[model samples]
Target: MIKRIYPQIQGEIESGEDVLEEYSRDWSIFKINPSAVAFPKNSSDICTLVNWASLENKNGHRVSLTGRSAGTDMTGGPLNESLIVSFSRYTNKIISIGDKEATVQPGCYFRDFDKATLRKNLIYPAYPASRDLCALGGIVNNNSAGEKTLKYGKADKWVKSLRVVLSDGNEYEFRGFSGKDLEAVMARGDLFGRVHREIFRICTENKELLEKAKPKTTKNSAGYALWDVWDGRTLNLSKLIIGAQGTLGLVTEATLGLIIPPKHSRLAVIFMSDMKEIAKVVDICMKFKPESLESYDDSTLKVAMRYAPEMLSVIGAKNIVKLAYDFMPEIWRVIRHGMPKIVLLCEVAGEDEEEIKSDLDRLKANLSGEGFEVRLAATEEEAKKYWAIRRHSFALLTRHAGERKTAPFIDDVAVPYENLYQYLPALEETLKPYRKFFVYTVAGHVGDGNFHIIPLANLSDPKVRALIPRICEEVYRLTVEHGGTITAEHNDGLIRTPFLNIQYLPEVINLFEEVKRLFDPLSIFNPGKKVHGDIAYAMSHIK
Candidate 1:
């Protein structure tokens, strides 16, 4: 049937075992061989594919499709037996670039998009650290936020509009709904209109419930962001779809809102021997109103030093290194200052260089009072030296872990900023039982209380896999207690999907299910993903 439908679209469709295997898994260890993969060239091709998928099969089951770009998602969002509509190859293109917005196909790489925007002095600030490899479509689906997220916000905030394709083959550019748009939608009285109207009613009716259900953390990327759809005044479908992880609908293209780049940025890398001091340091850093504050625990630094020695020369910060050495005898201290238990990277930005410098100086003075030795970046190049450690910390773990891979199952948790001081130790205590086998290393956007808990384990071993459920229960219990989200930055894909019920109220989960049904009633769009599926299903197909 797929072979027959291949000729209907301009895009290429391959169903051979070799081709299917290529589309199977993403960056995640989870793997599920797709039945077929399609490289769609345009929206027409996607529309045709989606419409065909909506058709009933011999057993009365409609074929399903999963939208994919880059296939670099850590979660198993793109892995399925259904047809995979991959956008990373032929469909990658910037449709149009405007003064404050850029319309791009789902396949365009984030780094490529950023470079194109930079030519016009415009910037897309929500790109993840893996921007070089991640695609813009993936960012929108995951609603990713990077180092500058504190100032510019997540991918959803930057998305002005979305060109989405519904399961029934209807394509629409969703930005927001107005009186006329709502009236027009209701006038049609079709499935799309009904879904739209139902969504509006659901959002408006559950506004308070939705608000109360939100995690107290500064940022979250879990389940459906129902709270964002209705902002008390406007009804925006794009906001709801932004972080739905392609389960609700397939995004063919996205029109992203851009911002002016910061004129100057000054960075400070502070080191503290005690893990407990991290909370105090973060509290002080927050008072300065810096753009981003990141932290790296001792375990992460131990692996980082293997790569850090060569970074100074690679970034070309020779002059700054000499000046920093003169400023303090401790400059000769190793990159991690003999592997301090905790390392904090704080960055402040503005239009004036002197102002940024003054802010950095004040931050340094404040941190110094708390017994922190600060390594102020004399130039942007010098700052990259510090940023390099944080940026490539995950890579270092991957490199060092010979056979055992760093499983991010419990990574990207964000507690309320104030709760972070207490949350860290409790989390460590939670993992103590499995400490012998599971390696725990913490690093991430500490400024927002979001940290990546890298728990390394050889999943090939049944012993390690057995402890996963218990470990997860303990960790999530602590996360819930602290008013934090079980999944932060990384959307609740397959790994976290089954855990949604535990994180959110039953009523909230019902809303997520309703949203899924309204957009994908036939369940032809990434089924068994966010709203539906069990933990056993999530735990299947390990790479």
Candidate 2:
């Protein structure tokens, strides 16, 4: 049926050229064409096709599928070819809206949804940096978070219910206790007994780790829904599927919690010559528990400058203007007698302007006590202008890297805040031995103990390309030694699968596999992803 109807769908399926490119490839370093693509019209369409695929797979023939939205993922969340499925067309409805809950098609964009909710003076605030482009499905899949995560938390936090299509062609609504609404189901003796049995079995087996699982930050989207368990209240099954990466089931739709938007916001810039100062400032700023505490090192600042120079200027900074010459010339760029090596571009929002000002003063005093300079954005507009510079600088600085620079991929690793000073220098030492390459920036969400790195190196030489991973491997190993994870924001997709085992122990890694097999026994739904043993298989299927 798909083969017959698909030919005609090429035109109707994609009303605009945007679909072709938008649905094409994920951020992974692979690409391929799916056998068929879908822009589901509703839950019915998503369910029917998924049920068909599940049945086909159970009969010893598994059809591969990949679900994606907006193509904004850098961790290979989208694909060009396969039985690619999308939610772009089914975004027209808001299933139900109550005082604190909203059931929506998972494809809705945050900006659109937030604007509508604002009319009613309500908000759905699991925002990500890419919220402007990210979809609800993508947010849940990645367990995404943003600067505001300090308060609202991640995608998983907002989920109240999930509409899922299980692997065996079954669709079920497994979710949080709906007050008295679900009292009937909870009272169903046999079904309730079985559901609780499976959940208890999985939880019991994972109890040890669950105790130790303390999320890296208040937010994370690592593997599955391991963080869904909580006592004292009734069980909420939807939480388990909230961050499952499309493994156990395909989320056709979801019902989530919402909030009220903040009335006021303040943006500020704190400059430091060292990463340590940023950490110190974080400890103090965290006390205010303001909306966000964001930091970026010079490497990231370079990019943000191009993208958000107004941000840098707000703090009285111009481009460091990196020289293409050699190590000696590059040294001049940071010499203070060097440009500032690191800066924190932060946004704090609240209801009281006086409180915001007081918080800014406290922040400045702490930063100044360390003998650093501080820049504050007087209003939201000015703050955004500066942020624009910071955001764009990540890309802007590279354009003139003079064929000597390559787009730096972020190594989303994190260690305890106190350990970063030690960890960072050790990482630099390993790089120094490979003299030809340049180091990128080291900026992060210090308040949460997670940082992103752009290890910009000139990998044009074959020798340099081979050496790249070797250097990264050393850094990854060091991070593990410090009891940190190799990935913080991005999951270990095909790109990082080869190193996953080294980072995770045999037993821990094995459990990840067990979970995968249970969810996708045939291994056709996103094969060669998020597991250890499939490293070799993943290398073969790039896109």
- Per-residue error (Å), model 2, residue 535: 3.9
Indicate the TM-score of model 2: 0.82
Question: For each candidate, what is the lDDT?
Answer: 0.81, 0.61
lDDT of 2 by residue, 231-339 (tens): 4356665665665556566777778788776777777677677654555676767777767777767666545534343333433443322111112322454563466
Per-residue lDDT tens digits of candidate 1, residues 59-104?
4855788999888787788888878999988889999888999999
Clashing pairs in 1: 29-543
Q: State which candidate has the highest lDDT.
A: 1
Off by over 4 Å in 1: 1-7, 57-59, 309-337
Candidate 2 yields a Cα-based lDDT of: 0.61
